[model samples]
Target: MASPDTRTQLLDAAERLFAERGYRGTSVRAITDLAGANLAAVAYHFGSKAELLAAVARRVIEPINAAQCAGLDRLLARTPDPPVAELVAAFVGPMYDEMRAGDEGGARTSRLIVTILSDPAEEVRSWTGPAEDAVRDRYLEAFTRALPDLPPQELWFRIRGILAVTAVDRVEVHNRLAGLPPVAGEAAKQWAITFLAAAMSAPPTGT
Candidate 1:
């Protein structure tokens, strides 16, 4: 049996490499080399590359999702009906912290998730869908409660918008705009939160 420390090392190495090269771009040998483990160790611990990728995702994603849910729960407990902005913050804040904390592994996992989600290939869904759904359902419920009057279709649109912005934000792509000042991390998050809150609250156009 692999020691706990060895398992952790393997996961750490896998997370960093997968983040850097992506799942398809990275290889089991590369991960094992970086981890200082052998091929046997990888098989013994995670079973396969696909499983390793899933493990890497779960290590980071599950915690962030839990934090998001906890934040929502705390807000709901304090007040029966929190404002749209607070709800948005609850959903976005933990993710922002992960992106801003300068954890390379977390950043890589975030990028990996965006890559998988953006891919139209159904196989990618097998790795990412369950983790995404676990947190998504909670936020959907919270948003539903926060904006009960919002039409279901419109609410789904706004929720998807929030997720799209989040994926883009995680990748941290820099697009140069002429004469536009840079927005720092906190500022960027605030902008997204404000935009999402407004989007969630906006009345249906056809109504």
Candidate 2:
């Protein structure tokens, strides 16, 4: 039986390791050792290394998802229909805020997201570690609403672009973009919102 604190400690270590080495690169012993915990703690808290990796990924992704969902709820509560811009912004704002706040190694998470976007594993790509299929479905409904006139494929493209822009990798890129200064996560979030707003608003070509 692991102590409650041991669980947190193990997760903290696992998050760092997973972010640093990726899923295959990190080892259970490494995580346990880093946490100053025993192997039993790892198994007790999370059944297997795969699960632990997923758990680590969840630690980073879950909060962002919650924030996004909450933001969406707020918009929906105010109006069943918001302007496309606010809808896009709401979809992305919590992420920006999280990155800006820079806790939970968000900068790293941002970079990780870039990797995921370009080439995600079977698991990570399955929408934030497999808990809420409905969330993505819900977001898609919001997206479809925002771009009512666009074809489904076009809307999906725009959504992909928005996801790409908001990716943690972009945050890293944002570091190098001149005139942007070395801002953090929130800046990335805001820029993504602005860019997405434009993309969402752009007139659809005859398609």
List runs of model 2 lying over 4 Å from the truth.
Answer: 1-4, 99-105, 114-131, 170-182
Residue 169 alpha-carbon offset, candidate 2, angstroms: 3.4
Tens-digit per-residue lDDT, 1-207, candidate 2: 456588888877876676666666778889999999887877887787767766666666777788778888888999887788988887777666655444443666666555444544675455454445566678889878766888888878877777766674444445675776455555556677787898888977773
Q: Best candidate, TM-score-wise?
A: 1
Question: Clashes per prediction?
Answer: 0, 4
Identify the leading candidate in terms of lDDT: 1
- Tell me how many residue pairs clash in candidate 2: 4
* Segments of candidate 1 deviating more than 4 angstroms: 1-4, 99-106, 120-123, 127-134, 170-184
Model 1 lDDT tens row, 105-166: 24555676676666565554466546568778877887788788888888888888888887
Rate residue 77 of model 1 by lDDT: 94
Candidate 1 lDDT at 73 equals 84
Q: Give model 2 RMSD, 1 decimal.
A: 3.2
* Reference-based TM-score, model 2: 0.80
True-structure RMSD, every candidate: 3.2, 3.2
